[model samples]
Target: MENEIAIHNEIDLQSKIYTIRGMKVMLDFDLAEIYGYSVKAFNQQVKNNIEKFDEDFRFQLSSYEVLELSRSKILTSIQVKGVKGGRAYLPYAFTEQGIYMLMTVLKGDLATRQSKILIRLFKGMKDFIIEREHLISYDEVAKLAIQTSQNTKDIAVIDQKVSALATIIEDFTSPEMKKDFLFLNGRSVEADIAYQEIYSQAKETIFVIDNYIGLKTLVLLKSVPENVKITIFSDNLKKGLHQKEFDDFLKEYPNVTVSLKRTNGIFHDRYIQLFGISEQFTALIVSNSVQLEILLNL
Candidate 1:
């Protein structure tokens, strides 16, 4: 019973990251499903074991949040069981620690397995986010494009550099690479088709250094094979509010690591090291400042 609940929670955790109202915490629903009791029964367990859930461990949604969730259709459609208030049917949420405590309160073989899987899932998410934060800051990219536009001796030189960069990006999407990857041109619409072709041949890993990563980017990263890794080199400038969530996620993945270093005096060199080993790699560098490389099969 506990194992079933934990598995259900794992699936739930993947979607309800931001903790809007309406999403049921795993243990609540899982226990209810197993014990033939209401979510209130699960809540009673938590109430009985308050020590298990600290401020860092758990929290409830605000009335305003609950209302917003109701408006947005983000809350669960499941009817409330033991809840006595108007919000009983609304979804509730829990943190990693909260879930852990809930398991201790429940006390069963299933509870133990559920707790382990939950911790692992949370850790994995943390690792992913931390790795993502290491990507290039948006300001750095803008500064570089501006710097090149201002300093280049002739428009042709700037054009040539952009062309070369475009070509290199295009080659990444070749047909030969398609079997291994499903690349999408993130930086430019024009690069989309070509980038797809190059990515098909990719193996072992995929690296991307871009300014921004939203939901679409996250989905793509998750699509890669487990054996393959991805690394990004970029500047860490902004303290976006959502940044913390991602930072927490990167703590989960052991294979992925992030490093923040200088690129050029002005613009950070946003590059990737894909399918590379430590000693043997290939990279392109235009200026003495922005050096890019791939270490093949390290």
Candidate 2:
């Protein structure tokens, strides 16, 4: 039974290797967590060093791709916020070589330790693969038995494989950890969701901006508590651009201050930053001419 258990464990691990289809992928944010860098900073590094990473090792997520991920229910706690426009480049997924390159680039005490541990773990997996291949001939009889018996032994073997696969997955991916960061994608809607999260945590200091504001946005902005200090800066536009009713609603919130900076170029990119108790959360929104294109595209 002990030897059977050991062989089952090895088989389960091997099955996953095949199941993965030889494509090693790690989310950019997850890799960032390992390297002790914020996801934003980590992505910036990748953007800066595009030559080091090929399409096989790294690729940005498209808006549609991100939307697909949102449907998976994996993003329960974190909302995917958009960049300046409604579209967002998805988080890059890295291959094995990319992970190795990342460790080299992000070298430090913690990174060194994580790299060493990961390398050793991968080595162990490789060894397990080699050992399993050598034992393939011995398993032929067991395999034949499994095929011949549609009985209890076969069911037990199947169950063992399934459970072992589960264990290997748990070990390999390092699940069951708290998520440190999340992403939000879309236009101003993304900003609204991300800030609401900060508000849920009872944040006080918040900064917001939107060159094109309307009744819907004004309603969203009104949700902020009066005690909270909010400074909103936006591009100066012709009076009555949004509508008289929308502008009139602004008078109701004295604590929430809005400033319009005059600029010929039109302050198009919208962003909101919230300095909570300890951490900072920002959501980028696109307004002005870009917003028109987004609506047209939609």
User: lDDT by residue for model 1 over 1-298, one digit each (tens)?
Assistant: 2224433456655554554333335434544554334567777777787776886666655556655544655545433434454434544467666666665677666556655766777788778769988887678889988889777757888899899888756654555543333223322223233333333334676665544433333334443445665554334345321455556545654444432333333444434445633343333222232222322333
Q: What is the Cα-based lDDT of residue 138 in candidate 1?
A: 78
Candidate number achieving the greatest TM-score relative to the actual structure: 1
For all candidates in order, the CA lDDT equals 0.51, 0.55
Evaluated at residue 254, the lDDT of candidate 2 is: 57
> What ranges in model 1 sit over 4 Å off?
1-9, 20-37, 73-92, 136-298
The Cα error of candidate 1 at residue 85, in Å, is 10
Model 2 residue 124 lDDT score = 82
Q: What does candidate 2's lDDT look like per residue over 1-298, in tens digits?
A: 0011121232322222211224645567666655667677878777777788888767665556556655656433223547443324466667667777776666566666666755665578667778888565646988878877867777899999999777644433444311211233322223355446544443676665665555555556666765666665655344423547645776776555444344455557766666654656565644332221121110
**Candidate number with greatest lDDT:** 2
